[model samples]
Every structure is written in C-alpha cells, then in structure tokens.
Target: MTTTAPVTTPKEKTGAETALADSWRVVVLNDPVNLMSYVVLVFRKVFGFDEATARRHMLEVHERGRSVVWRGVREQAEAYAYTLHEWHLTAILERNETD
Candidate 1:
C-alpha cells in the first residue's frame, strides 16, 4: 500500500487584508509649531538623511504643506511614521495610490 499527500486550498484574502498588503507612504506634514531648522534636524536624526536631502524634505513640508518621506510595506511605513510622531513631528501614514 502507498500513502498520498493531502490536498490543501488557499484562502482568499478579505478587503482589509488586501489593503494591508498594499504599499504605504510615510508623510511629514507641516505644522505651525516646528521651526524649519528643527524639522530638518529631526529628518536627519530620524531618517539619517544627509544635510541636503534633509533640507529638501524640510522645504517640501514647509512650502508644499507635506512631503512623502518614505514609501514601503505597510508595517515599516507605519513604524517610520510612528517614530516621526514620537520625535514630535507631524507624521502620518497614507496608502500608496499606485499600489
């Protein structure tokens, strides 16, 4: 007599689970409280961005009201956004539209 492997079926993902699988963006929104210099400093400290790159993102937030600082998987984006918030920056997570 011989044994055979059992069959298995893949489960379909629900809407919320599908949404979580999509990419996410970490955005830093401009706020009245944080100064331009301080924003740049925080960007550098939190993200390890160099002076020029940090300044670029800071200016984007200052002039454009917000900047997409990082884009990646949802979990990491959430962590980055949370870290920025912990640093007192106005950071938020947004679903990446292109995903």
Candidate 2:
C-alpha cells in the first residue's frame, strides 16, 4: 500500500478577526515621576506633533488618568508603546473595542 501526503491550505480571516487585527491603541498614562513638559517633548519627538498638539495630548494625560496617543495596526502600536517605555514613560497597548 502507498501513503499519500495531505495538502494544507491557509485559512482566510473572518470579519471579526480582520477588525481585531486592525484595531490597536497606544496609550500614555500620567505618573508623578515624569514632568508634564517632558511628556510633551517626548510626544513631539516621537510622533512629530506640533508644540500645540503635543501639549494637548500631554494635558489629556495629565488631567485624565490616561491618553490614547496613537491608534493603528498592532505592530506599530506595540512599537510606539515600547518606544515610550524606553523613554521612561508610562505607556501601554490597548485593544480598540469600537473596531
């Protein structure tokens, strides 16, 4: 008797899976350790935001416990979160539930 190999094919992603894959957010949380000015500066440097825009995000993080700084695909969101962590900022990745 001869044995035959089985073929395998890649599966397509479902709508929910595709939505989840495209939904990610990078958030910065306020911490007593870092100065507000520093956070603003970092935001500007990392995201190329203008002084006003950076200050706006900084204020959001300061007043509100956290701020969603960026939203995009998982890889880039993770990268931004990691980079912020490297900068000694309180950053985290979150799933965008609305997606």
List TM-scores for all candidates, in order.
0.76, 0.79
Model 1: number of backbone collisions: 0
* CA shift of 16, model 2, Å: 9.4
Per-residue lDDT over 1-99 for candidate 2, one digit per residue giving the tens place of the 0 to 100 score: 999999989999998888787899999999999999999999999999999999999999999989998988899999999899999999988888866
lDDT of 2: 0.92
| Model 1 lDDT tens row, 1-99 | 999999999999998677756879999999999889999898899889999999999999999999999987888888898888888998988888765
Residue 99 of model 2 has an lDDT of: 61
C-alpha-based local distance difference test score of model 1: 0.89
TM-score of 2: 0.79
